[model samples]
Target: MLSVHTSPLHQPGTGDAGGMNVYMVQLSRALAELGVEVDLFTRCRGEARPRWADLGPGIRLRHLEAGPRAPLPKEDMPALVVPFSLALLKEERRYDLVHSHYWLSGQAGRIAAVGWRVPLVHTAHTLARVKNAALADGDTPEPPSRIRGEHQVVGSADRLIANSGDEARALRELYGADAGRTEIVRPGVDLRTFVPGRGRAAARAALGLPVDAFVPLYAGRIQPLKGPDVMVRAVAELLREAPELRRRTIVPVVGGNSGAGPRGDAWELARELGVSDVLRHFPPVPPAELARWYRAADVLMVPSRSESFGLVALEAQACGTPVLASAVGGLPTAVRDGLTGMLVHGNDPVEYARWLRWFAEHPQAGAVMGRAAVGHARSMSWQTAAARTLDVYRDVLCAERSGPGMNEAGATARSCLADASLLEGREGRNSTLAALLS
Candidate 1:
C-alpha cells in the first residue's frame, strides 16, 4: 500500500477546513477500509505532542513535528519541509508510492521520493493562476517565491492529480504539465454525516435563531477570496427590493472565523449596507452543527471567485439544500445550474440580488432543486475518491517499472534500503524501521 503525507492537516480554528482537510481525513479513512495500510503525517501543533490515531485496522494518523510546535499559516510553512522530510526519511519504512497534497507537501514528497526511490504523486488543490486571478484586488498578497515554487513542483512531479476536469485543463494551459501526466479525480464527501433529516429546528434552536426565520447559509472560511462581501451586498440589495423578505424574518448565517483576514471589515461592510440586522456571522461550527445549519437554511450561497472543488456545495446538497454559487473554477462542476442549484454570473450584487429574489418567490422550484441536489450528492463519496486515487498510484507505479532496460525501480528500492542503513543506530527505532534499516 502507498504511504501518503499531507502535512499541516489544519488546526481546528483555521479557515482551510474546506476541501484539503476534508480530503485528507476522509480519503485516508476510506483507503484504510479498502485494505490499504495508510499512514497520514501532519504537523504537531502547540502541546499537542506526536500521537497516533488508529482510524481503522489499516489506517493510522502519525503526527510529525514540523516547524514550530505551534500552528503556522500555510504560506509560511514551506521552509519547514526540508527538516520535516529529513525526519520522515530517517524513519525505516518502504512505501510503494508517496502521495502529496498541495504544493508544500509536494515539495517534501518529491525530495522524499528521490531519497527513498519511490514514485511521487502530487495533488495541487488550488493552482497559483486561479488564486492570483481571484485575489487580484491586492486584498490577499501571496509571495512571488511561493508561486515560483508551486510551478516547479507541478512541472517536476511524477504525476499530477487534479480535483476536476477544469483543474486539469488549467494545469495543461498554465503550467505546461503534459496531458499524459495529469489525471482528474474529483473530491468526495461523507454522505453519512451530511445526510438529510430533521435538523432545521434543532440547529436553529442551538444557535438561538428563530425557528420560523428563513435562513440562507454561507459556510466555510470568512475571507475576501470567499467573497462574503458580495453575499452581504446581495442580501442588502434583496432586502431593499423586497421589504417583505426582511419582514419574513430572513437571515444570512455565515459560518467561519476572521483568521487574520477581512472578517472584521466584512462585518463593517454589513453595517455600512444597513443589513447588519439580517447578517448572522459566527465562528465555524462542528460538522454535526454544520449539518443542522444545512437543513435549517432555505439556500446555500458560495460566491467565491476561485475554488478547486467546492466541498461546501456538496455538503449543502447532501443535506437537501439548494445552492447559489459563482460560475467560476470548480464550482460549475460541483453545482448544476437550475438542477442542484442556481449559478450566478459574477460577483455582481445586482445579479445575486436577482437570483435571491427569484428563489424567494419560487420556493417550490427551490425545493425541487434541493431534492435533485441530494440525489446528485449521493454519487460522490470518499470511498469513490479513494478508489480513484489508488488507481492513480497503481498507474504511476506500473509506468515507472514498465519497459526493458528500466532497472530504475529496482535501483530505487535498493537506494532506499541503503539510506535506511545509516539510521540503524538511531534511538527509538520501531520494528517497521528496524526491519527496513537492516
Candidate 2:
C-alpha cells in the first residue's frame, strides 16, 4: 500500500491526517486479519523513527526517505514523488498489486506498479475538482496541477475505489474515469473501538460534560473546507433563536490546526459572534478517546463544505449519537437523514442552527435517533469492508492474468469472483455498500 503524503503512525485530526489515515490503518488491519500480509509505505518525516516497524501480526510499516526529515507542505510533495517511487522500487520483496491512497501516492504507485509489473489500484480519497467546486468562503482552491495529476491517475489506474456512489459519479463526470474500472468500496468504522459501551450518561460523566447539556460536537481538522466556521456560526444563530437554552448548551470543537496553513480560527469566529463561552476547544485525541467524546455528545456536527465521506459521522453514530451534518458528499449516505440523523441541505448556519434548536427542544427525539444510529452503524464494519476489498483485489489480479482483451478479462474476473461465496453472501446486505461505507 502506497501512502506517500501522510503516515499512518501520525495522530489523525491533525495536519493532513484525517479520515484517509484512519481508512488506511483500519483497512490494512482488517485485511491482515483475513490472512493477507500488508506493507504500508510512506515518506519519512522524522529522523528519530526506525526505517520500518511491525504494526501487527501481518502488517508492516516501512518509511522511505524522500524529502527533508521534517514535515513539508502538500505542494512540495509532488517533487518528492519520483524520489519516493525510486525508494519504494528499491524494496527486495515482490507484491501482487500496488494499492495507493490519495493522488500523491497514486503518482508513486504508478511508478512502482510499472517497475514491479503489477496492477495499480488507486483511491482518490478526495478529488481536486470536487473540492474546488465546493470551496469555502476565503478558502484556497485546489491547484491546477492537482487537477491535472488526478486526470493522469484516473487514466493510468487499473481500478479506482470510491467511498460512495456520489464519489464514483464524480469520478465519471468530472475526471472521465472509466465506469467499468471504477468501483464503490464504502469506508467502514472500527466497530470494536467505537461503540456505545456504557451509554450517554456514563460517557457524559467521564468526559466532564453536564448530563443535561445540549452538546453538539465538531470533530475533525480545523479547516475551511471542513466548515468549522459554519459550525460556530450555527452555534451563534442557535443561541439567538433559543436564548433560554444557552445555559445548557456546550459545543466541543475537538481537533488541531490543519490545511494549507494555520486555519484554527473557529474560536475567533465564536468570539466575534459573542458565543465564545459556549464553545470549548481541545487537541485531537486517539480513536478510543474520540469515541468517548462522540458518546458524550447529543449530535455530531459534520459541516464539511466538501467531504468525500464523513467517517466522523459514522463514528459518532456508532457511539449512539446522532449526526447533524451537511447534505453534501457521502454524508447523505453516512447519515440516514430523518431516520438516524438530520441532514441539513446546505452550509447555511440558519438551517444548521434550526436543527440544533430541534435537538435542544426535543431531547427525547435525539436519544431515540441515537438508538437508531447504533443499529445503522452496526450494519457497516471494517471486516465487511476488507472482505469486499479482497474481492476487488482478486478481480483486478484475475483481469491482469487474462491479458490483452478486456472482454475476455472482464468475463474471467466476474466468473472467478462468483466462486467467493462467503464474500458474495455479505454482498446481499450491502448493495448500496459495495462492502461497507467507511
Number of the top-ranking candidate, with lDDT as the measure: 2
Winning model by TM-score? 2
TM-score of each: 0.88, 0.92
Candidate 1 TM-score versus the reference: 0.88
Model 1 lDDT at residue 196: 82
Provide the overall lDDT of each model, using Cα atoms, as 2-decimal numbers.
0.74, 0.86
TM-score of 2: 0.92
Off by over 4 Å in 2: 405-438
Looking at model 2, the pairs that clash are 187-437, 187-438, 188-438
Instruction: Please provide, for model 1 over 1-438, each residue's C-alpha lDDT reduced to its tens digit, 9 standing for 90 to 100.
Output: 222223335532245555677777788888888878887776665545446767668777666666777656666676676656666776677788778887777766766666677677888887877788778254766677667767766766778899899899989988887788788888888898998886557767776778767677778777778888888889999999988889664565545653444344668888899988887666666777778888888789898878898999999999989999998878888888889998987789889888888888887788898899999988988999889988988888887777342234334444555555544543523333333222
